[model samples]
Target chain A: MSQFSDPDATGPMAQGVAIFGEFVENAQGVTATVAVIGKKNEPLYLRLFDEYQTKELYFQSLVFVSLDVIDECVERKAMQQDMYLGFLCPIDEYQIYGYMTNSMIKFVVVLADVHRLQDFELRDFFQKVHAAYVEYLLNPFAPLDGDKIKSARFDAAIERHVATILERPPPAPGPGAKA
Target chain B: MSASANARLGEQIWQKMPKINAEFFTLTYGAMVVQLMRDLEDVQLVNEKLEKMGHSIGCRLIDEFLAKSGINNCNEFAETADVIAKVAFKMFLGVSVEVASWNDEKTSCSLLVYDNPLTDFVELPPNINLYYSNVLCGVIRGALEMVQLRVECYFVRDTLRGDDVNEIRLELKEHIKDEMAEEYRRE
Candidate 1:
């Protein structure tokens, strides 16, 4: 089994890190941390699921730190066309992925190392989150400014998406896998 | 126009208009009402504000209604009632209202709304006495006023208040004449 030893391999190599099929069996217990950042980089919504709930502050700081990388990625002309920024910088044992909407709102997800998720799966997750966010914004009570999202409905929607990701079936093994 | 014809027209217009998710619209309106209640701290004031806001929306929406429906005029108050219940309601809200209870003078009637999108996900607290869909009345009043019809509209019954159906009572006060032209002729 290949280990993600080099944290600096944040280019295409890091995005392709999901190729490690060996970790598929142990993926059920993987925890995820989700964050929403406003245009001014203010934290709008942050949620940590399962085991990561205890380390709330740690994940909060990590999500804030990932904003710089997201900003740099967004500034690049080539990456502007695609909302999904792929695998962002890795911090400690978790990997960060970023997605930005047309209105400049940013969504970050941090996943524990044991799980394996394909690029398309991550994109799907972000798309669902985006749909929920749009619905939340449609509420006239939800201010357009940098106010933190405090709606119970919004929280429930995000939690449902996170649950789906956690319960997703692992990717099928490739032809080169050792049986 | 026949009721069926108006229904068909409303359906056609509804198809042509750009649409958003119904749930989103419902939630947005619900949240707005809740926010108004919190800020105003008076159920009556919130109801008035909602009506006022709907009045502005109606003033603008009438132009759209005229443009899209290609309706030049309604010759009688009865015809106007039919158009409002069958066409206008369906065109904007995706639901058709039942126009009933016309008095002998035919100047007053009630529009029965069986399915109100605004109150789809809403359940009012027992302590709160509010007209959640009062904006619909304002919209009708404002729209009719633009067409030179002086009408009084108000919620007679609300499904939120355990009524069998939502009823908006409409009473025509007068048919406004061309006051500006009359003044000019007098001068």
Candidate 2:
């Protein structure tokens, strides 16, 4: 029941990253790499840096940080109905998947490698992980590592996820606690 | 909720008139607050200036809200909340109003944004605790309170994805709608 177990609980971008990281960890058996990028460009995997490498990137270091989306939407003057909920994740060979939220915020879980595992199960796993990442974000303490994880927010997020896994509803009183 | 009332409510008088677009108003409001912050050099001055500005907006906006909604007087806090959410915010910002649950003595509400022009590219400096696009809440509170309803307005959540939704919670202690008229009678 580790707190970070729920990947979907993390905010949208973080959730996308965590889902990709978890998928890579479970399938490729590697720790997810993190980097701090700015809003100048979309979220993409840094090919220069390995997955586990930690780095301190400035606000302007990597183009396309979080604020870029807000800026793009603003600049375009997109209408209210056109609002989108999705994640920008780069997988390989300059290919990135922007996972938008379903009505329930579940990722559609498309597969890049069909031969690796049960395609259906893997998709479900991805959706679960996405949901957990979103829950992790609700903790308010989760690290918003645009590039690398350095703050207490990330750890706190992990801790909260573990708690959610162990949490259960209280039992209904049979006779009367009030009496 | 009456049929005729709802029918009357749908009309946007401002929409037809050559009024400022919502984006322009929101951007100008945000820039004005930002400028005040830079010039005042004190939190009190900043707060006072924002209240004053909101008050001016409220005085004009209230009349428009009432006129559009066909609600000349709100007898209860619930009705007032409804008018503000349905009429005032929608007319001005093209967003819906949502009354949120309270965590404490402070009540809360949200001006739901399908699109917010003010927050465009608005990267809040990492040092600031929260953005102040919610100065509208203060304006509403100050104006309504002057009219007699004591409201504590604050942001509960910002609807902006990634960023929090701008929430303006109005906690009402008593029904002061009658007080406005009572004061007028005294005068």
Candidate 3:
């Protein structure tokens, strides 16, 4: 039970970021989900939930390179609307999505297009992850040292959130498609 | 805070302040130490691991602290110290901490955590370097570093180690500039 407090209500912005790792939906499937939230120059937090058993060292290096790429984009003021929409990378069948907060905390997500998540759906996905991250950060007992997110609550939350988003019916075809 | 900000903060605090049994909390700390001792068999390693873990927590936890506090950014080093001792400690641990021993310049200071929930029942064996509460030092250092103020925080004395008081000494180093273009271009 939550102790002592008034009626509370804050959104994802109250928390930071979550899931700096990469994970494919299934080894049986052709697509995966990857995310990163970290500093550019100084080594802060980078995680990869790799489902394909890539070498740990390799994944870490890729994250640094991705961080550098996103940093360059931000520096050039190329990110007009959103980071993910700005620079989506296709590296060896993996498509990347990036999001940078004004605070310089950059978030990146990756998946194969064969899995083909639409831009709005990806936006919704990031939003859910953001909320899960907030829940993770609010836990006083959570240890800070490692890059890997060890919170079961966060994992469970993200799973539910993502499943809900994916399970929803796709938006209808635009009126312009009437031929 | 504006009405919206206040509502947000209230919600955050509600989620953060889960009703926890103090005894359970104490026991968990005890169990953590005991497990570390068994696994590594070196008190120094245990201390090191705990500090590293604490630093990790501090790095992430600070953002939540800042967001929920709703005071916007802090101005000076002294003010930051006060917020941690007063607001942060009070909110998380339900304890009031005393900030004292400031150097003439107010760049350095000592924090006395009189009623530390982590070390409430800790009775360390006769090891001077135990630093049973070293995680506090890491948490302080980690949390402070994120706010762009680099400081060296360590224990001068610990009540668990038979010291008359539990004290942490902090000395400010040079302020950290935000990560910039020149820095990233090299990387």
TM-score of each: 0.56, 0.44, 0.45
lDDT of 1 at B78: 88
- Candidate 2: tens digits of C-alpha lDDT, residues B73-138: 566565666666666665666555565554454434444444555554243433444445555766
Q: What is the C-alpha RMSD of each candidate to the true structure, in Å?
A: 11.8, 14.2, 23.0
lDDT of 3 by residue, A109-168 (tens): 655556666777877777666666654544443444534455444555554554554464
Those runs of model 2 whose alpha carbons end farther than 4 Å from true positions after fitting are A1-179, B2-14, B17-23, B42-48, B102-115, B159-164, B175-187
Q: Residue B153 lDDT in model 3?
A: 81
The CAPRI classification for model 1 reads as incorrect
Scored by DockQ, the top model is 1
The local lDDT score (0 to 100) that residue B161 gets in candidate 2 is 23
DockQ of 2: 0.03
- What lDDT, from 0 to 1, does candidate 1 have? 0.80
Q: Write the per-residue lDDT of candidate 3 for residues B1-107, one digit (tens) a residue.
A: 23344334444564577669886786687677767777988878988988887788889888887777766676677877777776776666777677898999989
